[model samples]
Target: MSEHAAVDQEASNARRGRGASGGAAARRAARSGGGPGTQLTYIKRKINVYEVLDEEGLALIE
Candidate 1:
């Protein structure tokens, strides 16, 4: 092959390599909860208290 053709072929091969591996890498990242630069947020709420009555006329607070 001519030098130019050889170079073009190598570039094409590289792009194919990256395309295949890139998808695998992306899938792995997604399965593992994404990759770097991924952020997660959580919301916190207060617990409520309640009162309960028993059959013996006793009150219980929880």
Candidate 2:
């Protein structure tokens, strides 16, 4: 293959890992209502809000 084609192939492997198979496991989890628990979930795992627990009194989470 051409140099550009070889480089593109390597980049794609790096992006998706060598044998990821296009996220079949994740799709199965979503379809069957199966997945890790809330704390283990990554969809909402990022801490976006910086709430003050001492001033807000923990009610913001509840």
How many clashes (backbone atoms < 3 Å, residues ≥3 apart in a chain or on different chains) does model 2 have? 0
lDDT of each: 0.72, 0.73
lDDT per residue for candidate 2 within 25-61, as digits (tens), equals 8778778878555664456565677755765676676
> Candidate 1: TM-score?
0.27
lDDT of 1 by residue, 1-62 (tens): 59999999989988786565467668888788764675576876787876566655563333
Kindly provide the TM-score of model 2 when superposed on the true structure, using C-alpha atoms.
0.29
- Model 1: number of backbone collisions: 0
**What global local distance difference test value does model 2 have?**
0.73
